[model samples]
Target: MIKKITCNNGLRIISEDISHVRSVAVGIWVQAGSRYELPQENGLTHFIEHMLFKGTATRSAKQIAEEFDRIGGNINAFTSKENTCYYAKVLDHHAKHAVEILADMFFNSLFDPNEIEKERLVVLEEINMVEDTPDDIVHEYLWREMYENNPLGSPILGTEETLNSFTKEMILSYMERHYTPDNVVISVAGNIQEGFLEYIESLFGQYKSVKKPVKSLETPAIKPIYTENFRETEQAHICIAYPGLSINADNIYSLVVLNNILGGSMSSRLFQEIREDKGLAYSIYSYHSSYEDTGVVVVYGGTSSNQLNELKTSIFDSIENVMNKGFTETEILNSKEQLKGNLLLSLESTNARMSRNGKNELLYGKHRTLDEVSETIDEVTLESVVDLAKEIFSHKPAISIIMPKKVDL
Candidate 1:
């Protein structure tokens, strides 16, 4: 069962108590990410994620690491396109200490100039590493071409020019705007102790933001343009994307079902036909990324340059077949079962439960029980998925490809 409380200052705390487990997972989720950044602010959200672990007013970076190590707990953080999360998994006995350290990092991070310089170099190298990775960079190119001038298209890692320009004051100013109490959610799951909610409230509550929360972001317009990057890589990587539904769309379950039939699993059509049947590509898959106002469905495949044309042809043929034939009732039923199985299996992990509750509270301000979700997935029918497939495939896809410099398409 999930319980929720809203602090006086507007911070939200959500938790699910799993009595059988001996561990606890806690996550501090903030509604700040690359999409919220201005052109100049590009990667500031991710940068702040790195800075928070550098040190706090009372704890050195090494001490912070050692504290968790001493407790045999795990503490880490990640910045995504929509939000940032700092989380820890610890034995139930050590939950309080873990939460205390997380709160310290959250409220009292120094963002020291010297540490910023060091981390900036580290992030720059990280960017360089991605650049050298063709498969990874190809997806980055897809977003760039698909969203064009929108901040949604901006790389989460930011450009070297922008990264070097960030200042401590700039970081603080950005956080001030997006890190308001109302925009934060604390999610805890696993073997929660009695009074733990009160303890979290005491730590996170009472800090009022002087500024109003940031305004809703402008929706990005999709740009379906084709782009190619020629690189000295062994294979050609391609991504074909079409507009998709928002996170709250009524037909999201249908789209998920369609995506599963398309390329979401090893038994998926693209995987079977493209990789297994024709042996045209070793890696091929499709996925959907849904945001607040908009989303995208992307199909990606990598193959030898010589086989790139055949792989592309095969992918298009497979999608066309799906649009023309739709899916059988058996296919839809099996896909629904597969999705539900995956969902239920994932919930067995404390970390997964913590993340689900955090993201649900952060995004929807509501929670759905496992039964409710399973029912919804079951409600997805052949007609719904078929109709959604036609609607999605009707659009001209934005295409991104990275190929060997010597190869010509």
Candidate 2:
């Protein structure tokens, strides 16, 4: 069962008590991400994520690492377009110790001047690493084309100019605005110890931010523009994207089912046709990225520059076929069953449960039972999927391609 408690300061805690497991996973979710940043502050949230691990008031960075190592616990954090999470998984006996360490990192990070300069260089190298990889950097170009001038289009790893300009004062100011109690959620899953909830509350509940969390109202309008990057790479990377639904869309299951039939699996149409049948590409897939107010479905393929046209043509043909003919009853059924199976399999992990509960609480503030989700997946019919496909495919897709500089268009 899942339980929730809101602290006096407005921090929300959600947990699932799985008494059978001997491990516990705890995540601290904050609504601080690239999307909330001003144009000048792009990647600030991700930078802050790195800074939190450098050192805290009472623990050196190495000490924090050693403490987790001592308990045989796993500790890490990630920054996304929508939020940031710092999580730890440990044996249930070490749960309190893990939480204390996380709280220390969260509330007491020094963000020392020397550390900031060193980490800035580290992040610059990270950015350069991505720039050197064509396949990875192509998606960043796609977002720039799709969202145009919106902050949503900006990369989570800010550019060198912005990174160099970020001062300690700036970091603190951004946190003061977005890292409020109301914008944070603590999610715990697995064999929760007695008084664990109170323990967490005692650690996280007292602190409160005076500033209200600010969200950007600038909704990104899709620009179905074709953009290309010329790189001296062996293969041409391409991404075809269509506008999709929001996280809370009612027909989200239908879209998921449709994506599966298109390119989600090895048996999927894009994989079977593009890779297996024609040998056009080795890596080809489709996925949906849904946000709060809107989403996008992207089909990605990488092929030799000489075969780039064929790859692009084949992908379009597959999408056109699906839109024109729709999916068979068997395809819809199998996709739904596959999704249900994946969902069931993921529940065995405390980490997965912690993440799911954390994201759902952070985004929707509601939880659906396993049966409820399975039922929703089961309810996705062929007609619903086909209709959604038609609607999604009707739009002019935004296209992004990265090709060898010598390959002439």
Candidate 3:
């Protein structure tokens, strides 16, 4: 069963009880990320994530790690384009202790000046690591072309210039504005014991409620553009982007099914045609990235510099074939089953359940039962998938190519 309790301070507590499991997973989710940042604040949200573990008012970084080790619990955090989460998994008996430690870190982090200086170097090294990776850097270039002039297109890791300029004062000011009670959710899953709700409320309910006003953003129109970055590597990294559905769009299911058949797996058309049949590329795949108001579907692959043009032509041809002739009933059925199996298998994890609960609450403000989702996927018809293909593939893609420095285009 799933339950949600909203405290007097507007902090939400979402949980699920799986009595059979002997462990519990807890997460603190903040509705702040790169999308909530200004151009100058590109990476501050991620930086704050790193700093929270550095130390708190009463515990140094090593002591914090030691505490978790002593309890035989695991703790970590991650930042995305839309949110940040700090989570821990522990034996059910230690649930309260886990919450107490997490609360301490959240409410009393010191953000020491010396620690800030030290972490800056760590983050800078991270930025350099991404630049050194060509396959990773290519996707970053594609977003810049797809969402030109928009913060949505900015890299999650801000530039070296911005990281160097961030001070302790700057970091604190940003946190104060965004880390309000109403802007957070606490999600707990697995082995729900008695008084668990009361225990969480006791630790979190005392915070004063302050709601941050929502900011208005103008949605930038998508413009198709071609761009190429030259590097001294042996292979050419290429990506093509087409505008897709927003997070709430009704046609998202159709697009999901369509992506699977096209290039989502080894049996996908792009994989079978580009690599298996033609022997052109070693790695190829397709994926979608959706935000609150906009989204994009991208197909990416890497190949030798000499075969780059053939690879591009074959990708477009496969897309055009699907658009013109549409996919067969057998193809649609197989893809649907593949997607459903993947979704169902993922639910076997307590961590996956915790993540699903937290995300549904944060993004949609409600939860969908497993049956409800399976039914939605089952409702997708052959005509709907074909229509989605025509709608998506008809557009001329915005292409981003990265080729060897000395290779001719």
Candidate 4:
């Protein structure tokens, strides 16, 4: 079971300690991401994440890195459409140090002007890398096409204009506004000390702060947009997708089963039929990505330009098979087992448990136990899976295709 504590400033902290473990994973999560962006503020959450590591008021950039590395611990972070997380994993002996460092990174970030300028360039380069790779670029384009420029469809990396226009003042203001305790969750797992609660309480309890209203987001009327990028690559990377469901949607579990049976695993139909059977393409997969209020089911593969039509045919045929025939009881059971096993295996790492609990508390309300999660996965039936398949796969999904300039289909 996980214990919950509320800091003085109302930041909720959840912790789970296991016996005999030599390490602890701790994470700080903010319930904010691209889904919360304004038309002009697309990538600010992700940018702010990077800026925190540059330097804090009490620690230099190099000091931050060296300190974590010196402790023989690992620290990293990520920003998604619905949340941002910063975490560290350290030996149980360093538990205090881990929490202190995690807290310092969040509360004391300097947001130095020089650092902001440098990191902007770094983020710009990251964006450039995203653009240069056709496989990556197509997914972003698919979102824009389906959502028609809505915040739900916006790139996690703020657009070029917003990234270029951001200033230290902007970053600071955004942080102060959204980084309030009410928007934060702290989670720790494995080998924790009971005193850790008091430590966090004493540190954040004094954080006397008031609430800031979070900006509201609206999903756009569904519109489909498609464009072809003529890049210089041997095989065409064709990606197509449409909106799925936001996180916490009742249909989420069904979407998971549908995605897995569709192309999530190597043994999935997409890999078996499109690659193993016909030898059509080397990479083929379908995934249903969920956010807080919206999501997208993406299907992708690479093939010779000459095989474009054949590839399209195979994809449609696969969908048709799922919708009409669906998966058998054996397939459904195996898929659920796959998902359950993946979830259980992931928590073997202290970091994964910390990150998972942090996100759950921040996004939803409580972190369900492993047994609860297992039960939910087991509850997914073949009938429910088929219902989801028919409901989702029956639609005429919007499509996007990318290929080389010189290639003709």
Candidate 5:
């Protein structure tokens, strides 16, 4: 069973006890990310994520790593477009230690000036790495084209210029505004310990601050723009994006089903036709990125410069066929079963369960069980899937391509 506790300070703790596993996965989910950042503060959230592990008031960076190693566990964190997560997976007996370390970093990071300068260089190199990789950078370009001036379109890594401008004072100020109790969720799954609830309360309850509600995102009204950059690479990278449904939309399940049939798996239409039949590309797939108020469907692939047009045409043909002819009953049923199987299989992992709990609560203000999610997927009918396909494909495609400079268009 899953349980949630909201402390007096407004920090929400949600957990599930699974007796079968001896490990527990704990995550601190803060409702702050690139979307919450100002234009001048594009990558501040991701930057702060890096700084938290640098050190705390009582622990050095090396000490933090050694401690987690002593516990025989894992600790890591990531920043997304809408939220940031710092998590640890450890033996059940060490849950309190992990939580304490996390709380220490959360409440008392030193953000030493020396560490800031070193990490700034580190992040600059990170930005260089992304810029050099065509496939990775193309998606960032696609979002920029799709959302235009919106924060949602901005890269989480920010630009080198922005990274250089960030200071310790700026980092502290950003954290102060965004890291309030009401904007955080502590999620845990697997062998939850006795007295863990009170232990969590004691650690987090004393820290108190009120946060303003997240500002509403301005919807982008820009038309789809095609971006092509001439580069000298062995293969041309392609990324195509279209508008998609939001996380809480009624048609979300249908969109999931739609993406699967389109290019989600090796057996998907794009994969089978573009790669298997035509022998065009080795990597090809479709994905849906759903945010709170909006979402996007993206299809990405790579091919030789000579075959780029064929690959692009084939992708569009696949979508056109689905939109006009629609998927057969068997296709819809199989995709539904596939989604259900994926969800059920993931629940067996403590980390997956903990992540699902945190994300659902943060995004929807409620938690959903595996059964409930399966039912939601099952409710998607072929008609609904086809209708959603039409709705999603109705928008013009935003295309981003990076090709060799010498290659003729």
Candidate 6:
């Protein structure tokens, strides 16, 4: 079990003492991301995340990066649909340096106007880079059609137009409004000493308490719709998605198990039937993504141009069979075992644990261990998985297809 502590500013901290680990991970998390933005401010949160490392109160971006690497540490950050995280991993002896630097990056970033404009172009390039690749764009379309105008439906990297419109003032305001201590979490895992904790306390404990409480965010209404575009390409890529339960839903475990049976692994029904038996496509998989109040289950595949429609039909047929007939006892037993065995490899890194705990605390008010997660996965019976499949398939998932520019239907 990880130990939990609340800083003076109301920021929560979770720490785990792994008996003799050589490395440590420190992460800073805030309940701010694409889902937290207003329509006009859609991409500001992510923009601010980018600006954070450009410069802080006392360090330049290059210095921030180099100093960490100088100590044999690695650093990175990412913004998700529901949260933004900045983290560092280093030898256990360098824990103080990691937390101090992370604390500085978060609380004291300088939103330079010139830097903002430069980064604007940088992000624009990023958007362009993704558009240049079809695989990236198809996922965005799947989310858009599935969630429609809701925040959950929005892309974490934001759209080109929205990102271009982001300005320094917008980022500053967004950061001030959403990046509050009460909505933040700091997690450390490894060989941590009491002095390192004290140093962290000294660095972050002085942050001023946010004047406003974090009100619950309202998720957008479901927009069940289908969208299709004809693209000329040699290879056809497709993504089919449906509204699934959010993390807050009681049936989420069932959803996980249900996905395992659908296409989560090679032994999954979709992969075995679609790839091994029929040789319809080289790749086929189903996965689910969950946020605080929203979730989407998606099944994706790649096929020859002429087989796009056939591939689509095959997927729908497979889904319909699962929804109506459910999984066999063998499928359920194997999926459960596969899922449990996969859990151990997942916890090998402190960074993963840090990020995992930070987000869980923000959502569920506490952290759940791997054993607890496995138990929940095991407790998911075939009936429950079948029930979840029925409920999810009721929405009749939508599809997003990508293809080479030359192949015509």
User: What's the TM-score of each model vs. the native?
Assistant: 0.99, 0.99, 0.97, 0.95, 0.98, 0.95
**lDDT to native, each model:** 0.93, 0.94, 0.87, 0.82, 0.90, 0.81
* Clashing residue pairs in candidate 3 (N, C-alpha, C atoms within 3 angstroms): none
Error of 3 at 344 (Å): 1.1
lDDT by residue (294-362, candidate 1, tens digit) is: 999999999998888888889999999998988899999999999999999998989999999999999
What digit string (tens of lDDT, one per residue) describes model 3 on residues 233-265?
889999999888887899888889999999999
Worst 10 residues of 1 by lDDT: 215-224
Candidate 6 C-alpha lDDT tens digits along 1-409: 6888898788788888886778899888888888878887776777888898999879999999899989999998888877888888999888887788887888788888888889988888887777766666788887777777777777777777887787777876777677888888888888787688778777877777444644467775456566655554457788988888789888888887789889999888899888998889998999998877777888999888778778888998999899778889888888888888887777788877777777778888877778888888888898888888888888855777787543443
lDDT of residue 149 for candidate 4: 59
Q: For candidate 6, list the clashing residue pairs, or say none.
A: 232-404, 232-405, 232-406, 233-404, 233-405, 233-407
TM-score of 1: 0.99
> lDDT tens digits, residues 1-409, model 2?
9999999999999999999999999999998889889989998999999999999989999999999999999999999989999999999999999999999999999999999999999999999999999888999999988998887899999899999999899989999999999999999999999999999999999998869888875778789999988887889999999999999999999999999999999899999999999999999999999999989999999999999989999999999999999989999999999999989998889999999999999999999999999999999899999999999999999999999854554
lDDT value, candidate 5, whole model: 0.90
Residues 172-286, model 4: lDDT tens digits: 6777667788888888888887687788777666674444847577866456565677776777777767567778987688789889989999989999999999999998999
Give candidate 1 misplaced runs (Cα > 4 Å). Answer: 406-408
Q: C-alpha displacement of 2 in model 3, angstroms?
A: 1.0
Model 4 error, position 408 (Å): 6.2
Using lDDT as the yardstick, the better of models 2 and 3 is: 2
Candidate 6: misplaced stretches above 4 Å?
A: 209-216, 231-233, 405-409
Off by over 4 Å in 3: 209-213, 406-409
Compute the lDDT of residue 336 as modeled in candidate 4: 91
* 1 versus 6: better TM-score goes to: 1
